[model samples]
Target: MKLRTCPRLQPLKESIRFLTRKPAQFSDGSRICKRTFAGHTTAQQACDALVYNRHGHYDDVLQLEKVLLPPVGDEDLRIKMLAAPVNPADINMLQGTYAILPPFPAVGGNEGLGEVLEVGSKVCDAKPGDWVIPVDAGFGTWRMEVVCKATDVIPVAKDIPLLSAATLGVNPCTAYRMLKDFGNLKPGDTVIQNGANSAVGQAVIQIAAGMGLSTINIIRDRPNLKELKDKLKSLGASLVITEEALQKPEVTNLFKDIRRPKLALNCVGGHSAGNLLAHMEYGSTMVTYGGMAKKPVPVPAKALIFKDINVCGFWMTQWKRNNMHDLSEIKAMVAELAEMVRRGQLSVPTCTQVPFPDYKVALDATTRAYSSKHVLMME
Candidate 1:
């Protein structure tokens, strides 16, 4: 039987022949074909396309390359990433030192704000066009899109800026868990924390204040200590003092008039932790989250034995996975904090937003900025 080809089929055959002979034409024509095809078809029918990737580390630069989009599974949700913060953990991931190590040629970014472009058949809670924040750590949030388990993505407030939502997974959650779970904080109680100028620390201050708990913040000596102290105090800190002042004998009497703090949050280990512990009352608990100095915390035997001081550690990822109650509390706290930010009651501090175009410069700035304060990277 002889098959007759239509006039439209003739041109398609010619174009295919031309593309077969000169593959470069195929590359050039693919975009036009893709656009036309996309206009005619729905997203579910289209194949996954290339996005972004980091191949390896060359000097300080993350060797980024464009690659094919990842295939989504039945339980996965495909997200179009809008913003991801360049947090300290992201830098650590690049250095191959972070606790969570993603596979090589992997994307790096822990927290990101994204829109669900598509979800597999089994994905019930997520839907296309829903703005969501990734709940999992080190899920390659740096890329323009990602495929993750639907359970790993959580819906976020639409009114919140994508930048703010991008940072929702880590610091704020850490602060919430540390304050509520480890501290067992009650209304009208007081909490003390070193690294009080950190993002987590600042969140703790705001959350504690909003929860009717006062804060005693300890920060390093900065040129603008007075201004920093005043700013922290404005954020519901009952008192703000330098680490040097914490070592002074007068610290005991300092909180005599104020509510004695039952909980102390320590991010800075070593001698700094000892100073924070000294300020805590008998039977008070101190939770160490991060060791920024990379030094071990030295708890005085007297405080542990005689004063009944409890020294504990908090890792937000592990805590969230292990304790459902703690996770629920964290979600509630984030909602409360988001409301506060909306109401202009909680401030995120002055952050320098770096555009994606200037990411390298911003990364360097973030490294240096860590010396003084937390540097928030906005993508």
Candidate 2:
């Protein structure tokens, strides 16, 4: 891969190894003292971030580099990051496969939890003690601190677990929106999803439970299926079945009373999705968010032509942009979801936190089909 120079990152001859003791200057021509650049200081100081000067392999390009903290603007807030999850989307972005590419010399995380360290003099939306998540996507949350507009951060309750708070901004938000936006699902209606054990799927299970909806969860066959099924059921899943079992009459009989699922949340496409469409109720909708199977949604023409089934797509990034001008709705949604978390109605996705120095472990975990979410945590 060709290494590209960052116009903004001049003066530093070496791209990856940053956060040095020398009095290096920033893109804005402001000097960052080494003491502050060391980052373990108070939130008012500079910090190090997982950055890539040019997009390529994450292990090759991503490095912890010192960054001058953006000055708190009139309506800005300074956030000290607590945790950030290493998601498939984060991997995709690192590999330059995501739809929205960050400009050169970009940071890596999208969703994470941060404590409000300091707010600009003119800010009022958030205070110093508040816990917040990104108001939109692409906040580069895998860092020590971030300073953004006050409105760019949505305050969440600090009482919840750090892992859950760290993840609330992405998978959970995606599940919540797909469950709401694509279909007019009512209480007791069944919503089937393939990646039922995934972070987003877990969020869908709990959120659906809170809304009085039933979730027909589908996961790939594994030796510990019962344990996984019990775990999802404890979170209020009405039914959890492996993709192979989906073809059996016994599974269909279980859903007889509930009727066929009216909504399908597809993350793993290909045949995993085909099974969902085959069992969908007439006039229902299937919203595809992820393609874990890395295959197309092979929907039968019969389903579309006769069953009147509707297929749609949901991306949290696009939704954020569409509602950027008006985020009151999402802010309220986030608050409600956080309450579910605080009350124990929602269980945070199983997670393993890796320290910033050991980020190679976290980055490697993303490419594998691990059951747990890998999070990057900074002390």
Candidate 3:
């Protein structure tokens, strides 16, 4: 495997050894930090990690290094990463454009699935062989293995598809919350969303369908539009129309048969957002979660004066951060979503699985428009 040079990391020509450090005590009176490699030297325990010392162009700053993980603490679990996806948010974080940025010399990924390899004596919440995922973003999941606080990760069922498990924490969670939090939606209620082909959008379609709600999904006009529409429809979207179709007179007729959408999910801003606003029911709520168009959402004066549309935004990261201390809500949501996965209501998106050693390929594919989601498989 090719390794990138990082000034902070020295080349390892042979196996290296180190002495165990003094144990540190925590609130539970558990002392940790003392560990033995079981005859394995420090170099033997070191694993590959994609790290960036400074934020900038990913290609310029990201490096693959042999990193020795810290010993599992009294309240920690050692995990072996199974799979992770290269997401737009990961790219944005690398560019220092995301809402949350890690410190310099940070690891590069935020979402992935891992298997518990070892658990601290005090970690009764998890055990070896349990599947787990990070409870929040910025856990640096791009490495082969990690030792993290037990409370920082949540256990998930292992029966779901690898792709679904790897992606469960972010997009699916975001979709689940938005549907439940806004519009006070009930079964048979209608919802509309732009960027209907995004990972989160697809999750919205499935989760909404499972909850007996209908979705009017809108995407940009593109080649192979029929194929894309057919795919989303198969995932339980009530209607799949292009952004242009949303503005046509036929759109008015289309809504006549179905209730006007009370909740509009806007991931694409600019005029695409205006079209959503144009169709929303009076006193409806429009939740903006992304700005793929990189343009501000345009709200018409008439819509405000006549329709009284309520506008708001949601960032899943912020929501997770706010509720990290009390995970009851998050745990319940994950359980519901997991049940949906077991029932096949939620399935993996169309994606290509690239081996961990070929992460560069996955990274490149993620930047291309209309490409399948690229996942990095640790196997």
Candidate 4:
């Protein structure tokens, strides 16, 4: 038998030849650095990051420092960060209050979006100009740039708003997984959640609505309670009630047109978490992902034994670690959410941009009662 050459394979061969060659200059005749990527790849000479050597409050622990970029190798990609969110988890980790702690003298951010500046030999999955997110936590995303294995970053759509892409990896992914892995939720099915105004909660409201599910949002009663309810309701909530209202006899009447919730999402543990478990349907599960109240979950064992009400906890960091090798599921979920964002059906949390030089202001904001989501943008 004679081997035959295929005509259609020529373009791929040519493209590979082009990418592998070392280009010294562009059409404009500008010299390229020997260390820089030979083609579309580019990068800065140095990087800056927020890191802490001691475990303490953000006010005392975090410090900004400039550092040299690590050398890139055959399996690495250079990433230039665009924006990263300062989440409750990041703050908890900073204070040593979180379940997973990084080694001492670690960087401060867990999630963000970045631009691929360059890829080393043997790297084909990601390339220059592609927008990507970190695949694991403790990536030290608070840094201005990174040089890591190509698999360390996952590509996302560059067209989505920067804020959406920057904040997508943690909150939205957590909401998607919890809403999916816990129960067999269906259209018009009721779902109750406390901390409904939280980033994940807001995500649940929109994603659930997109799936035809109804939500009863529980928020702390504030002076501007009605306004907050209106805002959340506009985001696809079926009903919004204050924490005080959760215990009211009339609250049940709101479910007249809907069935009692089979699932409850909890982020505010303590009395708030107990209220969620108390009001959910028998045999339902309450998933707790956060404890903003800084108190223990008050679960009544009587209900657990008789009503069969179960309580559980979730940490996006742990979930990522457990499923790090197989991220195809997360990629699919992200694409789905991206479509919602593209269609304007999903909205990012209200972010207050804090430039890198004003880091102190942003760090302090994380400890306050402010409603804005603090975002650190590279200078």
Candidate 5:
């Protein structure tokens, strides 16, 4: 297919889609047209290039166009995205259900891992070839490349798996913050969490185990509970129980040797929240981070007053913004997690990579796979 052009789109044509080639096959059977750089020979000549948003409604899937790089001033670095993960939040944002909204015609992606292709003269901390992740929450990350203030990118180890790094930012951060902030767990303390098979839940189990804390993980009964329990236990969970089991008196009796949990993490609301709260001891806290059931957290006031229990909410973006100084520390924790992956001490559940051309099919498959493990789309 011949490349099409418009009279008013000169800068876009010059910067982004200059060296267009025929769409080629990807490993997953998707096809993507390759883009080439021209004009500037050195990194200095490289302009910001991206999958531009021409126009669309909130319900529409983003129609990406190859456009010229946007203008960059002082203190900016141009980054080429390697991969971006598709999270439930990203889906919610596309559907306009998220609290934060991006401007129209903006690229759509929350988290990605990229390599710096050029750096502003004033940028002292980062340079070309450094692998980095975004520090800003809502900045568009779906494009092939972007230009942003140097301070917005957090440098990461180049050796880390780029796909894993792309998937790390939001969910893992949520898990880490919720456990550390609300739970105040000590080495021998036990904590209970619902949605134990979720990305954040899995992270909680792993991180809690790594910190010498035991996890009483509760998951909804699936067709294959044995497989699920075995998987979670391998990640260091002390025990994996079903929501139905919580209703049984014998299950609570089994925990007589362990302290009444001081913390409970609830992402699934509705009756699940009540079920999770039942396992917590008096004077403890329950942190609700999400409502996957699309229902309000229903906890008996008696549990609060009589038991002295506290319930709170968590949003990672807000935490990061207010606690910017803790970012370096958070990054160090992630790096340590990465090292654990290298040493076979930690592992994420298996994910299937779908091709970009099969996005529609992939998206449907992803929605269905939500009950299983994570689904990743790659070009």
Candidate 6:
């Protein structure tokens, strides 16, 4: 048998040797460096980053520092951050309230999109100009640039909307997993969720809609309630009701058009969660992923004894930890979600883009407006 060889194969092995060769050094051992791809110099670089020296109020502790980054090494990629979101979790992390906290003096963001400006030797999976996102949390993405091991990030298609790619790592993944994991869900199956206007909730609505499932979205009553309801409905929500409406007797009348929800996603907790449980079908599951209300979930005795409602909690960080060894499923989910974005099935939530240096404004906006999503753009 004869082995066929492709004529298009580049001399990668030789290039690897050249790329990975040690930097030249003088007699005294000081190194000589050269500028390479995308104007990256083979020397230590200084970049501006948002660092928190100690866990406390973000306003008090978070500082903008000129941090020195080491040169890219073999199997590493130098990423120029494009954008990162001012997620609630990032705030919580800075305040020492989140479940996972990085070491002191850590950078702020865990999710963002970056452009790989330079790749080190042996970095076959990613190359200059490819867009990438942190594969898991604690990536410290709130920086101008980063030198990270290729394994720490995953390449994503550059064709997706910039904001969509920037915010893709967490919220949409959470929504996608909860919808698929909790329910033996099928097209036309009904799912209900609280926090309907939340980033995750909006993602749930869109992903469920794409999967042919219907959503009974419940949000807290707001001043612009009508506008909010219309917005959710436009995102493919089968029904949009207020949390107060969930308690009203007339709410049941809406169920006449669709079956009771088989799955419930609880983000607000407390009364809002109770409302979701009250509307769930018998033997249905409710997955709690957030406690924005900072209140305990109340479960009625009848719900457990009569309805057999199964309650569980989902933490995206924990899920990633459990599946870190084999990320095929995670990768597949990301691919599907990206395709959805390309097809217009998934859209970036309402966002206020603030320049990276104006992170304070973005943080303040995020803390003040629960419904608004703020992103920090490097440019």
Q: Taking the tens digit of each residue's C-alpha lDDT, what string does model 2 give over 1-379?
A: 1222323222222232333433344332223334354534444556778876556798788878767775666777777888888888888888777776655456778888899988788876778879998865566788887767677667788888888888888888898998887779888788999999998999999999998998899998888888989999999998888999997877768766776889999999999999899899999999999999899999899999999999989888777766767778878988888898889888877988899778889988888874478998887
In Å, residue 356's CA in model 2 sits off its true spot by: 2.0
Candidate 3 residue spans exceeding 4 A from truth: 1-44
Residue clash pairs of candidate 6: none
Q: Which ten residues in a row have the lowest lDDT in candidate 2?
A: 1-10
Q: Which stretches of candidate 4 lie over 4 Å from their true place?
A: 1-43
lDDT computed for candidate 6: 0.79
Residue lDDT tens for model 6, 198-256: 99999999999998999999887778989988889999999988777789898889889
Clashes of each: 0, 0, 0, 0, 2, 0
TM-score comparison, 4 vs 6, better candidate: 6
User: Which segments of model 1 are wrong by more than 4 Å?
Assistant: 1-61, 72-74, 323-334, 369-379
The weakest ten consecutive residues by lDDT in model 5 span 4-13
Task: Point out the higher-scoring one by lDDT: 5 or 6.
Answer: 6
> Using lDDT as the measure, which candidate wins?
3
Error of 3 at 128 (Å): 0.7
lDDT of 1 by residue, 1-379 (tens): 1122211111111112223232111111111124234354434333222212222342344634333343567877777777766677677666666665544334556666788888899988778998887655645565555566676656777776555666666787888777768657789889989999888888889878878888899999978889888888888788898989888887778777777789999998989998888778789999988888789999889999999999988877665545433345545656765777777666754555655545565466556644432222323
How high is each candidate's TM-score? 0.79, 0.88, 0.88, 0.86, 0.81, 0.87
Count of backbone collisions within predicted model 2:
0
**Which has the higher lDDT value, candidate number 1 or candidate number 4?**
4
Pairs in clash, predicted candidate 3:
none
Better of 3 and 6 by TM-score: 3
lDDT at position 54, candidate 2: 56
List per-prediction Cα lDDT, in the order shown.
0.65, 0.79, 0.80, 0.76, 0.67, 0.79
Candidate 4 to native Cα RMSD, angstroms: 10.8
Candidate 5 residue runs with Cα over 4 Å from true position = 1-59, 325-330, 369-379
179, model 2: CA deviation in Å? 1.6
